[model samples]
Target: MSIIVRDFQPADAEAAAETKRAAIPYLVLTPELVAWQVTHAPGNQRHRLLVAEVDGQVVGSASTGIFAESSKPGQAFVNLSVAPDARGRGAGTALLTTAEGYLTGLGASTAYAWVLDDEASTGFAQRHGYQRSRSSYFSRLDLAAIALPSLPPLPEGARLRTAADFADDPRPLYDLDVEAAADEPGDVDSDAMNYEDWLALYWHRPDLDRDLTSVVVMDGMAVAFSVAQTDRRGRYWSGMTGTRRAYRNRGLAKQAKADSLRRARLAGCSEAFTGNDAENAPMLAINGWFGYQVAAREWRYLRNLTD
Candidate 1:
């Protein structure tokens, strides 16, 4: 009954994703997506995925990487998960230790992690010398049960388009993403400055459902969008829903989300999920209007490696 932590292998994709799903059901994870994350990560991110095996069976996983998009230096993150049935073992501690060592080797001065807002989870983080920081809410909506709001009539010159419409030229969407992400609340500031990096790390992600991702276009410009990710397994996730700063208060964000939700339902998605920073009141209110209820909360924990 020995637990060993090692670098994740391609063959472990399914077992790794299953472990993550059992530990955090709200996430939309699949073997293909997991493999994409490990194999196609941006060079600057220094990403590494680790798996914990107990008696030759994978039971937990951890993902660690530097926040390449953040303007701040030395910022890194580690997300660890252990299957429910595998708890009470030392797998989690081993995984965390290995992840931290890897991040340290990458010159990371600070490490951040998201821990479920519960006694056991928080206690484990605290025991590891991590302090609670900002919190985020995970919300889920029953697409099959809730009646989606009708899409608002677009402004005189505005039209709704799917992300696929930008397959030939995604620069417009990239610009909008950069603008919206800069305004998002978070501990580390992210700029999404490099288009090529964005393409590899986000736009080209295997889980991104371009057909379901709705974009708002006014005249000849892309103003807002709701990025959607689906597993075609009856689950849908709102990756990002934002309106350019210039177009705020025009209901563009809401419209984009509405259109995306309708598309998801029409595509046979049963459940929809999203997450928001606790301080993001406007987005939270918008999600509430869509009938998304808070399913869980996680507190961001940080530790200074130099401490």
Candidate 2:
């Protein structure tokens, strides 16, 4: 009957990852990634993983940290997840309270979170003084059921490549990521990530599956790509599918997705998941082309930390 919140230890990685999986089914989460978040945060920044224990069992976790790479300061984030079976035990509220206090101590002026688009979840955010902002839709594709669509033929000068092909020089891919990310819709303006930051943040992440990540190279330039992440189980996630601005409308993004997904299924990934901002009509259309169905929706919430 007792619940307590504590700092996460290295040993809590598996249980914490499992707790989050149970809370959000469509997310591509793994213990390695969970642990990496704690270990890879910038040394000078404030970051912590808070775990909720109920009768000695870990039932929820909150990832709290400052947005160190944002163009604006005082932007912090908390992503809290509690196992469905343990929801009513006050674990969620306790975790959120602790997380907010930690962010406040770090001088954060704004705290942001993504809450499930349901009455209970939204109400909880409202009660905590968080205001609704934007929403995104999570979608899933049955890689094990439907056969993947064939990759469309690329124009004569362009061809398909896997992320693995750039093992020695990934700078081109990094350029593509930056160009695409700058156009992504979000509440905070993100500072442009340098090569080293991208390496630590994305390229070197344990969950990135290079062989399954498809890239479209036109004249030796990375013009479009589909970044793939895996749990190394049966779940695969489309981390991002993006094309350079000039490359749009040519079905290159679709080609990238189809190529990446086909490879994923061949590698034994049974399901694929992705999220798109509600206003991103282009990517939404591309996902729809691949038969991805809406799995869930999450609304972004923000709270001002001061009076």
Candidate 3:
């Protein structure tokens, strides 16, 4: 069977979402979110989504874009996923070729991809000229079957709130995110510095669950938060859990995550997922404390396109 790779059409959203979910079950992907991402991407991102088809059936999907928020220049990323049954049919190769060409044309000197931490996946990346880099872990909690610890009583000057509480003014939360993101472990070090961009790319996203997003207020300041994303099918995702620098080591991040998970469980969510850089010990420990076990691991791979 011949495999064809082409730009993704609006009609392929459901199939693309299915392909992605089949490849990485813990990710928060839905048809609507996919469509929103393609139609609403920021100008700097130069985002493009592609799909691999075989005999009129879409079997793989790929997303490529410049790392607009990266401090480094000429950095781009391509993430591709092929359905298990569709592997080894040239779909992956075709998709990668299309993605790399797209990035190269956009002046990207380097391309990054995340491959599952397994022999076959690693070998594939290596064969394609990508070198292993940092790794990360995907963790999941059975919100319905596992017991979540009761949120500890707040300190004298702290209380919990939801993102909805900031509807009138989200600048405080955006500032807190920018500060917290500076310390996050990643190959690229960049802060979400632009409020308008952050509002367009994150706060107003279709998948964000404002009511379920938990925030910790210390003396009326939003010091910590756990952003939540949920699909209608009962899967909840922790988009980001962060605590400001001054509030570190105080279990405030845990409190925020716990509160968010509790809210998700009460809202009938069955499974909860989150990811962490392998070296993020504090967050890893907190996830462990929440009974979230590592379900999968992925290693970032980089290819120097300039060479």
Candidate lDDT (C-alpha), each: 0.94, 0.90, 0.91
Poorest 10 consecutive residues of model 2 by lDDT? 188-197
69, model 2: CA deviation in Å? 3.0
RMSD of each: 0.9, 1.3, 1.1
Q: How much is the lDDT of residue 50 in candidate 3?
A: 95
Model with the higher TM-score, candidate 2 or 3: 3
Residues 1-307 of candidate 2: C-alpha lDDT, one tens digit per residue:
9989999988999999999999998999999899997888665447899999999999999999887657688899998999999987799999999999998898899999999998888998999899999999999999999866666578889899999999999999999998888888888765646777678778988999999999998866999999999999989999888999998788888988898999899899999999999988889988888899999999999999985
Q: What are the per-residue Cα lDDT tens digits for candidate 1 across 87-178?
A: 87899999999999998888899999999988888999999999999999999999999998765588888899999999999999999999
* Tens-place lDDT digits, model 3, residues 22-61: 9888898789999899988888889999999999999999
What value of lDDT does candidate 3 attain over all alpha carbons?
Answer: 0.91
Candidate 1 lDDT (Cα, whole model)? 0.94
Give the residue spans of candidate 3 off by over 4 A.
none
